[model samples]
Target: MAVPEDWMGAPPRQPVDLHTDRPHAARVYDVLLGGKTNYPADREAAEQTLAALPNAGAIARQNRAFMQRAARHLVSEAGIRQFLDIGTGIPTSPNLHEIVQATAPQARVVYADNDPIVLAHSRALHTSHPHGRTAYIQADLCRPGEILRNPALREVSDNFEAKGSHVNARSKGEVLRFFHGLDLVDPGLTVVHRWRPDTVEVGAAGWSDADIPLYAGLGRTS
Candidate 1:
């Protein structure tokens, strides 16, 4: 069944429904990260947001970095081999799977998102280490019960809930509601930049508590 060495391993590509006219959150984030997978509408919306909040772009990038660091912590420190990443955005390099698999190649990840565009480009997420596995689900969180009952989400062992959708301010009590039943890991629910900061430059950047509007806490359901 082996093909000749001169043969190309993969087949040709086909057309996918990108819906170039509409703007999706994942695509809009891709545009902010300077990725090329976005459409004109996404760019326009991003530009408008940027015009209103000059710090918006920086916030997005900072959030992305925090996500990576948090995933790495889960794998390296917490020894989590399973991940259920809801609201999973467009596949960027060193994605959640990539980061976790780096330390634990047997890690399994299920990325769920509501965006059709994310579903279209999900093939990238399928690439897992030979010892690991990855899957994607197209579902909306509007139906929280359905998401909770999903087979993929049920497979996750190490649980964490940190979402990027909140651009508005949230009180600490509101944030603690997310971890009502679960036990929080050390350094519970703080600004993204302050979470186990690696270097003095980042930890001492003089970023105010209000500079970042997002709250993230790592918790376990045990």
Candidate 2:
């Protein structure tokens, strides 16, 4: 199969002015995930946050595990081949792309994040596979429409449909409007952890405003 020539290369890197003096969410996640991309300020902030929620590290790991499981379910059971992942934190190994691509090599993934550090690391670590595709967009969760309309995401979506599979982007309400013509999967527009929880009853009871710092949902284009 001939991959689109225009989509073959990585997106041009936009120069970012890093504010290492203050803490960023992505850097804090990197620190919590035991990555080396974080600064002292970020580490301190992460530690402070962890101090407040003693299970902060565990929660981070659990969140990653949930992402992995969800990607697997989407590829294996749901037959989804394209993904638009917003709030893509640091370039953690076995990321959403890695999990889905492992199950289905033709899976196309577009990761978006507002963090400059995430954008840099995503470009470096989240390149597309030879048989599939991946792209990173420096976009905020508050602008889901922008992400859905991104040139890179549109290209990937086109490729995904050519393979006879579906595409869905995960983000909060800002992007939900972009899926007006699509059908949301069951349990529409809920927290990531709430989707297919290990125990729905326990998960429901545990739900709190703070538990879902970010809203996520899956939808199929109609």
Candidate 3:
């Protein structure tokens, strides 16, 4: 089914700029999840990585489930109405906005990523419920102050960081520093699998708690 012009938002303010020959983390992740948004180089890189780590695909799925669980926790338990999700890869089903808005239709979400491919597909992520809102920012996380000060994040009450991001091989303490001033929620900075796993959502990629590759933390600005 084609999305009619009237249903879509305004065109992206900037043209999509990307290098198809280079393998990018965002695109590789898309390929791992069986998405068609990636280039041949991304698929090739993903295949090579999977060949090296046979469970790579499964771990990727688990990571995505972890994201959904975090969003669910924020909406159901924390009563958070706004969210800022960094390192947001290609928009996948049950995205942060989808998961949160399903329960709290007025939830507002901002997704930020440095990848050009992610920017290209950000339009899909911009769609929100009639009562909710969502936005995307193309940004590099190295500048923490920038993300914290971005206009889009001004209304964010809760900031969620899915740790163990490939670029982040830092010690746990170093990673926790990112949320220093904020108050952490229950099960603070724990492994993804340990954060109130929703079995129904994890499906076949339900790897052991110890096997989850990423760490997830939620913090409030209070």
Error of 1 at 155 (Å): 8.4
Local distance difference test scores for all models: 0.74, 0.73, 0.74
Off by over 4 Å in 3: 1-12, 152-184, 200-210
Ranking by lDDT: 3, 1, 2
- TM, every model: 0.78, 0.68, 0.75
**For model 1, the run of ten residues with the poorest summed lDDT:** 5-14
True-structure RMSD for candidate 2: 7.3
Clash count (model 3, backbone only): 0
lDDT of 3: 0.74
Model 1 lDDT per residue over 1-222, tens place:
544431112233344678889887788888888777788999999998889886677677778878888898889988888887778888877788899999999998878888767866876545878888776666787665566666555554435443323323458777777677788877888887777766543433877878767777777768
In every candidate, how many clashes are there? Answer: 0, 0, 0
Candidate with best TM-score? 1
**Model 1 Cα shift for residue 202 (angstroms):** 7.7
Candidate 1 vs candidate 2, TM-score winner: 1
TM-score of candidate 1 relative to the true fold = 0.78
